[model samples]
Target: MRNGKGQERKASPSFFTGEKWLVLTGLLGFLLAAICGVWVILYGGPVFPKGDVLKAFSFNAALGVFLLSTAAILPFTALGNKSRALFRWSYIVLALYSYAAETVQNFRGVDPRFVKGGMPFDVWVGSIFTFVALLLILFYLFVAVQYFRPKAYRLRPELIVGIRYAMLAVLLSFAAGVWISFNNGRLVGLHGSIIWLHGLGFHALQVVPFIAWLSERTALTHSARKAFIHLAGTAYLVSLVAVGWQTYLGHPVLEWSVLPVLAFVSLLISLAPGIVLLRRQSDQTVPAGKAIL
Candidate 1:
């Protein structure tokens, strides 16, 4: 990790870094996503499609990017540090099984959960896949619970807060996954799918945190930055609830009228704080974060 000159050398990103096998596994997820997405495209215009690979690959790609991106920050979280080796390793292995199940079985045109006929894929493989998926959810829930307290996980002030909220959202995502499983499908009715709520829940990993990073770039006070984080986080959470309610009512959130309005309005609320902060700083000659940039 160093040169002959003895200057502090950066650790190169690789398999050894923070158990980055997760990132490698995540890339495989994206590859599966691309494959399934392309398959759906070629299959033509059916919204639901013949097979359920749309949700399969969608889950892979979304969780892929999330797991991949969040791996870098694992070292920063106290629960993810070397002190908690067993928990860390267990999560990685379980996650591998869960993701691998999706990638392999989905590509084979088999439902990893619902396979029948008492074949090996159904009795053993599918059962194991279901168990692993549940285990992975518990693992993520453990993390979310641990990381919700900043004292438990260390990071920059605003970012730590964002992480707390994001992980909480991920916990909800896992909950939503369970809901979908019990319901046997994402569709709530004629047009709505809980998939809307499920998919976007994972996205909180980026949404509010990205806003935190953006807020850090302004000439705002530290307290001001933190306040903006809260505002944005609340708005984002509200948007999720609005969308969830819309989906549960068997109406697509994006459909015209109140359904779309409620979700979009919540999103707009998150933007207001950032906009106000940026506008207030516009008169200043140099932004506070210019040096860091």
Candidate 2:
């Protein structure tokens, strides 16, 4: 009976084992939903009557959905450390804040420029939907991470520095993009959440490097992880340059295609370290001090 129990324990999942197919399927489902959203923006009928009103709706809708989904899914996949318990609660707070924002917006009016077509605090529904979507994503993300990855994963200081630097780069890039757009008077011209899309995309690009750094410290060991990170970083950098060049050429890729890709890629990259570490060792074998930051 003792031997049978031991055998059963061995058969059961450990940290080293990868997530089941179902969790991955959910991730893919979210990706598909994102694609559907993009399609609506590019080809579907306009939501608002006027041009600018429609533009804001399109932009806000897309961005709100992306952030909500990310905030929901990523906490579970990468950010579920005891240290990050604050963040988990913060998600809840943010959801409530979203609800409040919607309520206030209804009173404030959806469109400042056009009173006729707009309803008071009109974006309320969008906000509520975004918040709920975020909540669901986070719940699933948490479940996947908790079950699939080791709980006590320690992130290296260097990796933390890398994350900070990546964030700094994203901020600086966004500021530069905004400044250039403003000075060029280009900012005044674009419809939809083009600026937000650019900002989010640039930030997402930075996440790749940060993930690489973390992967080196945790999931991967020896020279293998380093090699993979270096290669992946090179690929990411190349892609960024290519995207920038395209945008500069006055033929930017469609936001529908670009934004969701950026968000998903960033989320996936951020999870690499934890996923790798969990994949390489059993839950009991993995040290307990390590936690996601």
Candidate 3:
């Protein structure tokens, strides 16, 4: 592709070829997870009593898809060849083990919770899964830092910034997940919460970049586009924090509360400057006789 200066820019080497297996497997896993999610929504009953077969299938499927997808995209960052190979193998092995462990625990009606007398097989396996998953979080954190480094792999600034924010969110979510696991899935007041925040945070990896990409296609100036990205990321983080605060207060995510309302209002307030800047940028781009709609 040619830049504005008419110079041709060579595309970065595609990670897809090297990671084809991961991509394919990840896509398959995601499809399976989607099917399972639908199945559980339609046929399954309550989500509790943890050993339900459909629930297990759905949960494991979702986890597998997430791990596989993470593995697939991780090499796109600035890892050296050796590091990339090691991460790839480790991720694949851990993902496979995690799926197997989940299946065994679910089928055998094992609870992930540890008992005073002895830990069940499921708890042991689940602990292993948690450990491996947390290790992967370190890799994500590394990638997040790499995004800001001088020699980092080239991408649009929006994508780099988005990924960095998303990884931060993922790290926070994983840390919270570890805490909840140790506390037997809930703190005294919080009950079995934190899931909402964790889910929202982790998915920011997709959501922020997608929004940034869409915004890049608009007629905004580079600075205005960046303003939009920063605004969106800040709003996203604030929303997560608000939900997390709610959960910490031992409230359901959707429960009417001052925190959430304030959070959204804060997001809108934070976005106003960006909106104004974007409007000015748009106006500047218009022709003398033409009006901006």
Candidate 4:
């Protein structure tokens, strides 16, 4: 495949062949759902319209179904022939079940909260979706491990690292979401900030991989690419922290404060790794008899 600039893009492994449409559909669902969420926030009044909220949940369920199905199928593309067939069917069945459960919950207007006096039928079904989603985290970890292994598929180093870190971020966000659900959708330490943390962490799956993809289209050296990934990821994490801190102090998400300054400083501190590596290279190039500058 070639990009718009006519650069030949790396072909996805055969394992993922014929799956591009599925990924695209999922992405579209996610985008539409995000737009709906923003619309609800802007136009649905302070309490929000129940209809819009329900529509958002419905669209979200569709997005989850498509996205999770894509995630579940990708691993099979790289698995050994013997294991591939078995795992493919297993993953398909699991993904379908998860998707069906989530869709049913949304259609039934089930509240996702774990209420007292035992959970309702639809809530129980919704919980199954959550459980299956969390279990899929192990599948992501497996994909990350496979990508990291020697003689594995020919993924770019930055892309592999991005996927690995994105997996971790997703895991953390999933755990946070589960915790919030159990606590009646209230955050413990950060109040409203847990939403920011969860949102930032999950979106790393898109952001980091995008950075890697764009870097690959450039004339960057491997070291430079790695440094860029580190810097971007660090800045991403710092921004998350800044927003979380601000929200924890009862500030709105868009409120400006010293947190941005702190986040900038933290991002600079994160560059210490790259800086140290550069200095080491400089020291190696210096003459034996030369005094250090």
Candidate 5:
């Protein structure tokens, strides 16, 4: 620990800080929600009508929620206080987007169902489900702020944790698929050729920013960046293949394949940016040591 004059300097962002816990919590929430969402899509059966689905999870609203959630948590975990405004606004955007989605769904002749029992397409029940998703995102946002403090910060541009999360997401998706098949006789919506590849493309897009952030933390060499970029591109291609297969099978949520692809793509993208900015302080690097604080 040395100051400018080479005197003793205490290391900043002490180990006891709560940033680590916040990140862990956020990551856990994200994973849990992702698993549940995938399960609902793959195994849970039709909870809402098609028009309602469009209304509740519109294209723009879905992107906003996904990115904002990522932005709210990932950056806070890494950069600490650097992007306070962005994080705060992400939350605001998340709420507004959810509200708008619900409203749109209602406006589209999608009446909320008042079911006495458990019908999957019950409108009221389905809308409530959206809140569950929103709640997960909101809780993660809170955890991000409370955990990742400003002081002793450094981004781990390598993004090992994120990659691990991605792997977990993949496992969860596969589990969801299997669970559905075992419980019911078949996979409901996301099983066959009825699926759409574009949804998978959107999933890939969702993860790019997160990976880009990871790249900001590491000190990547030019060659490494190029290699990583190629890897990311390849992962995207893999996602496309998976999506195509799902579509060919008429699967309902063919887009589920994108989550893992996003994870790999994110890692690759994050690693590549390090090459050009290796020498900088890497202000974005949140201390891996403190990830559980």
Candidate 6:
């Protein structure tokens, strides 16, 4: 390939390795944890008086899903062969840290995030967990930086747009995480739960990309695809903002009001592409669009 001078040019590298292990492990963890959560919910009581372990497996299931979602997006990032080994090992360690931080700590009846304990729990486990979490945020920040590079121009327009917006939400989640660490609780204003906002921010990684993914499989004009991407991206961010606003105000996020209603409606709008895709799939009416890379 050449530029104005028509000289040969080597393509930039952005391939990700070890995504398969992350996907397989995460899926297995989710299924196993889900089964355990259900069984515990049916037949067990809280291991701790605070009832932390009672629902521990359920949250572990969610953590597993988080890993899977992260795996899904890593291939699209600008990671190169030179950095692949380090990133892959770091991800594995992070996965283990996440699993232990939630599951084992809960089983031991210790609060993973904000524990009041000593010895192995405090100096060892707690400090390491915080460091690991920071490492994850920093890792994603590196991905964000790579996405802005010219190599990212190789991405499809809508995919890149979705990735950018999704990264914003992720960064916002990191910010909320920092706030939680400082506050030592999920509670914010009044009854508002910062954790809820945090979850939404992270889940945007999956939701926004899903729309772009579906659009490639459905019959849509170029304008239509771009429009859907913008709509979903903007709507999702708006919903996040609305929730953040209400969260900061210390009110229930779903409290019946203009902001909450707007948030709910925007979320629905963001997911509308999926509904359309499903209906078309059922009716056998969706024409194939461009092949997804």
State every prediction's TM-score relative to the real structure: 0.78, 0.37, 0.75, 0.61, 0.32, 0.83
lDDT of 4 by residue, 67-157 (tens): 6444533542355755545444554555556545533433334443332343466556657766766665565455546655643424344
Overall lDDT per candidate, in order of appearance? 0.67, 0.40, 0.59, 0.52, 0.41, 0.70
lDDT of 1 by residue, 104-194 (tens): 6665666776666545754687888778878878766666666566454223445667667777677777777888888877788887888
Model 6 bad stretches (over 4 Å)? 1-18, 35-39, 42-45, 49-51, 117-120, 277-293
* Candidate 6 whole-model C-alpha lDDT, 0 to 1: 0.70
Predicted structure 2: lDDT: 0.40
Residue ranges of candidate 4 with Cα displaced over 4 Å: 1-78, 81-103, 115-120, 186-191, 241-252, 260-293
132-235, model 2: which lDDT tens digit per residue?
64464455344334323432112232232333333333443444345444453333334322353345444543354445444544533334544445444444
Tens-digit lDDT track for model 3 on 171-278?
777767776776666443744277777676776666665555545455555566666677777877887788778778887766557976765675565445445544
TM-score of 3: 0.75
In model 2, which runs have C-alpha deviations exceeding 4 angstroms?
Answer: 1-44, 51-86, 95-221, 245-293
Q: Weakest 10 consecutive residues, lDDT, candidate 6? A: 284-293
Best by TM-score: 6
Query: What stretches of model 1 exceed 4 Å from their correct place?
Result: 1-19, 37-55, 116-120, 150-154, 271-293
What's the true lDDT of residue 169 in model 1?
73
Q: Against the true structure, what is every candidate's RMSD? A: 6.6, 11.6, 6.0, 9.8, 13.0, 4.5
If both were scored by TM-score, which would come out higher, candidate 1 or candidate 5? 1
Which 10-residue window of candidate 4 scores lowest in summed lDDT?
A: 284-293
State the lDDT of candidate 6 residue by residue for 1-293, as single tens digits.
33223434344323224577777767766775876677577867466633365556766676677777877767666667567556666777786777767667666667676667544644577778888889988976877776566656354445666777788887888888887899888888678888777889888888887777666555566567668777888888888888888888888886898878988998899888767655654443343333322
Q: Which lDDT value does model 3 have at 221?
A: 58
Candidate 5 per-residue lDDT, tens place, 1-293, comes to 43223445334332214334333433443444444455447645233443333323343344444443444334325443645445445544444444444444443434332223434555454566355444544554454344334321233322333333332333333333333334332334445431134333434334533453444344444234334534554555555555445444555442446544554455455445333434444554533322211
Order of the predicted models by lDDT, top scorer first? 6, 1, 3, 4, 5, 2
